[model samples]
Target: MSMIKAHHLAVSYGHGEAALKVVKDVSFEVQKGETFGLVGESGCGKSTILGALAGRNKQWTGTLEIDGEEIGQKRTRSQLAKQQLVFQDPFGSIHPRHTIGRTLLEPLEIHGKDRRQERIEKVLTDVGLPLNFRYRYPHQLSGGQRQRVAIARALILEPKILLLDEPTSALDVSIQAEILNLLKDLREREQLTYILVSHDLAVVAHLCDRVAIMQSGGFVEVATRQQLLENTVEHPYTRILMDGSRGYVSERRKSDSAALPA
Candidate 1:
């Protein structure tokens, strides 16, 4: 079952002559329970596509269908609730002054969902957080814990799809792994679909089943995980990303080896 379908999706800022099209003609479909990735350098329109799908960016022209329904620029509460976005920075996205519980409660209140307390507890547990932690503010948590809360907030609505915008980028290297693992586990446990946007192929490889390589506002290639692992991607840009990732890994390995005492 296709959870999301988009075609000729162009998202822009401003209007008329001054309008800058950040995402050019791009199209893709994400299946249920699948993790689809958009991997590209910054300013390559990766987040723009996510914003368009999340209905945050209204200057878009395309045919977008979510869970078998065609979506317009404006969405109803129910339509908006069908998908949720997890931003790049947990510290920035989550309110510093708000308790985790209060933060989670805001969306449920807005959507007027019932059993709010039960939902909040369940989602916190789902994201590997203790129930009592909800009373704590974002400043009280570590980077990884804060991200788990962010994920918890996104999951509280019980949306079928999650739009992850560089979800682990702001964390420490070790914390990034923990968050990625948490996301992988959540996807299966919740039967959720994800559209992950990132610049790191390794991160995408960790969670994504398929990846779309974008450059200059459009997709250059969409390759499967197998192709990435086997180094069999046909597109030059895909190969470049793979090589770049490999080079980073190689450098990290060298650094680690150098730091090891004999």
Candidate 2:
């Protein structure tokens, strides 16, 4: 079953006399328990599309369905909480002033009045954070730890679908690998449907089952990871991105190779 569906989604940033369409009729579906990646260069409306799914932008015009229910133009808090968005920058997503416990409790405090402590402990354990470190502030934790906290906070409400907007982009490669694995395992255990947005094809290749290539606010190509990386199909936009990424690697290899023995 599809967890989320977006068809002919168009987002405009301005109002009245100066309305500009940033996203141009993008259509896609996110399957349950699978990761659907949205990849594109900066300013390509990837995040704008993600915001539309999370219901962050109200001005967008399109059909958006979450769990078989058509989401209206104006979303209520309860309807909004059924899905969650995990941001690109984990550090920015979490508040420095709030400790882990306080951070995790923020959503529950507003929505859930009972079983707060029990919920906190469960989410913490689920995200691989212990209850003892719940009092630690964001500054006191490592990058991975902070992200885990962010994930915990997102999962505390138990949303069925998570819109991950470059969730691990800011972290180092080693840490990113760990976080990705954690996300995969958690999604499997918790049965989450994810819409992952990133600039790296390699990252998307590793995590997403299927990927959609976006350019200039439109999806020029959609294919599985194998088709994207291996098949090297013939969309001009996707080819450019893949070629550029490969070209960079080729140049880097020559540079590194030149420094070694013949």
Candidate 3:
């Protein structure tokens, strides 16, 4: 069975004269522990699709089944916890006033009152944060540390699927590598399923198992990393986007994304 299934998923904002469809007829399924990527230029409805799946965009009309449970117009927190979204800006995702430790504990409080102290500590350490940093505020940590804290918060719930909206975009290249490595480690350890949305083909290739090229507002083609990097896709729009992003795909990083589609 699939972890997520969306059939003819369409999203729009406003109505009548002001209506604008963000994503039209988009369909795909993410299997257990599989990393499916959504790639295209900015404003191509990648983030919109992510929000719809998260049940944030109310104007959308579609069928979304997550882990065999259907999502109607509204889904409660317990229902939403089955799938979690990690936004592009880690700073925005986390509250600056709340310390790292408290932010991680809120989810536990919402779900149950018994408290899971051991679970919180394990997630914090697992995300590459040192024990001493637990009490620190968001501003006290560096960009990379803050991002790890965000990831730690998401993993605290132990969701079956993660919707990553450019999780590494706000960090530097080196820091991006660290976050990527951390994600890889967590994916293996937790056996998590990921639906990553990004404009960076390099990032998509490195983290995703299957590549879906979204153009305008719909997915034009879907293929493997080898097919994308090797310029093997025939879809005109996919070819164009690939050519535009070719400079980012130099020989230096080819070795890095080579083993990604596993």
Which candidate leads in lDDT? Answer: 1
Q: Per-residue lDDT for 1-262 in model 2, tens only? A: 8888898889989898898899999888888898999999999999998888788888898899989999987888777788888887877889999988999889998885589989999998988887898999999998888889888988988899888989888998899999999999999999999889998887888889999998888998887987765645557677667666555566776566335432
Worst 10 residues of 3 by lDDT: 253-262
Kindly report the root-mean-square deviation of model 3 from the true structure over all alpha carbons: 4.3
* lDDT (C-alpha) at residue 16 in model 3: 100
TM-score sort, best first: 1, 2, 3
- Compose the digit string of candidate 3's lDDT tens values, residues 1-262: 7999998999988889999998999888989999999998889899999889877887777688898988887888878788888888977888989988889889989988355788788888899888767788999988888889888888888898888999999999999999999898889999999999998888888989898889878988888877876667768787667656767577666666444442
**Candidate 2 wrong stretches, greater than 4 Å:** 247-262
Error of 1 at 153 (Å): 0.6
TM-scores for all candidates?
A: 0.93, 0.92, 0.91
User: Which has the higher lDDT value, candidate number 1 or candidate number 3?
Assistant: 1
lDDT of 1 by residue, 1-262 (tens): 9999999999999978999999999999999999999998889999999999998999999899999999998899999999999998888999888999999999999999999999999998888899999899999899899999999999998999999999988999999998999999999988999999999998998899999999999999999998777667878777667667776566776566435442
TM-score-better candidate, 1 vs 2? 1
lDDT of each: 0.91, 0.86, 0.85
TM-score: which candidate is best?
1
